[model samples]
Target: MRLTVLGCSGSVTGPDSPASGYLVTAPDAPPLVVDFGGGVLGALQRHANPNDVTVLLSHLHADHCLDVPGLLVWRRYGPEPAAERALLYGPEDAALRLGTASAEVGGECDDVSDTLEVRGWVDREPVKFGELSVTPFKVFHPPQSYGLRVVDSAGAVLAYSGDTGACSAVEELAQGADVFLCEASWTHDPGNRPVGVHLSGTEAGEVARRAGVGQLLLTHIPPWTSREDVLAEARAAFDGPVRAVNASESFDVVKSGSAVRRQTS
Candidate 1:
């Protein structure tokens, strides 16, 4: 499977990137988009038809899922609209949160049933989409959030941390995966930041080291945060390959015949 970085900015849209968003795709399967935050819809249009993909949100935070409502517009009113309702998976309250955000009138959620088939994710239960199986793992975040472990028919695994703090669940989600796309929102300054919110680059690398993941890809670095600072922190913690991913970069993920790790830029 191929993973594309549509956006990696944290908390809010940054000057150089959008909020958190990633595109995962494979042969003959519909594109699976994770965390459709701001600017993702526009970025996705560059690679695939916006109406021909499945969406999965990690949480209801505005930076992680605000673009979903924009997607509804394209699928419903674009030049070539969707032929059928597309599937969207998120936390249990996904329907309510998305609908409320799309609402035009005050205190009313616009009915998104017109173009989206919203589904709630059950923790650890894998949802099959053709050749891919997506298992959502509960993570530390506001409202409801998850870390997705995607496996292809070839048994190649791609794990995403999806904006989590230092938690054992995040390590479990990334255990022995090929590419661990984890978040490192800021520098390693515990006293300066709040806990149970986001992981530092040091924490992200520790998770990768403990889980024995193949490659560690740090993401969700806000524009204000020094990229080099976080990169140094991760490298100091993990001797394995660790890269600070950027917007529009793509990675080809594979396995050595099984669930062993192998990746290419």
Candidate 2:
């Protein structure tokens, strides 16, 4: 399985990158996209086909899921055939959140939702889409959020912590994962409260350390926060392989025994 970083910024689009979005692809199935943040459409255009993608939203935050209308427009007007539609999975209110935005863009919500099959998650239950199996666990975030563990048939697992604070649920989801795509939206200072919703770099690294993940890819950094600072903070806590993912970067996961090799691209 291959995991691609479509966007890796936090709160808003960074000067050099977009908000949070990722793509996970296996050999036999189409790519599964996680989050559809602000700049994800452009990233998808450069890396993959929007029509053949399946989106999994982490939450309804603008930075996490505001590009659905643009993607739908691209699928409708682009060279791709209308028959090619994306499958969308998210929280229970995903359709409502996206439908409202699509309507403002002069796009029909029903048509968009019909073209994209929307599935709502219930904690811990496994959902299947082709060869990919997704299990969602509740995370620490206001208004509800989820941390997803995606696994292929070969038992390769990639866990992603959607914008969330340090929580046991995230640790549970990330346990023994090949790659942990976690959010590091704040600095190292514990006293500096960042909206009380997101995790700092140290916290993210701690989660990775405790989960015993093969590799930790820190993401969701805000434009104001320097990448160097985040990396340094994470390194202080996690001795394992940890790096910050860039836009368009890809990580290949190879199943080896009980663990997997997470190769960066």
Pairs that collide in candidate 2 are none
Best model per TM-score: 1
The C-alpha RMSD in Å for every predicted model, in order, reads 2.2, 2.5
Error of 2 at 168 (Å): 0.9
Tens digits of per-residue lDDT for model 1, 20-71: 8999999967899999999999888888899899999998899999999999
TM-score of each: 0.95, 0.91
True lDDT of residue 200, candidate 1: 94
Which residue pairs collide in model 1, if any?
none
Local accuracy of candidate 2 as per-residue lDDT tens digits, 1-265 = 8888889989999988888889888877777889999999888877777888888888889998998878878877777555855678889988877887888555445446556778888999998877889999989899679989999988888899998888789999999998888999878787668554888888888998999888888899999988898899898999888888888888777555334344555
After TM-score superposition, what is the CA distance of residue 65 in candidate 2 from its true location, in Å?
Answer: 1.0
After superposition, the stretches of candidate 2 with alpha carbons farther than 4 Å from their true spots are 105-111, 194-196, 257-265
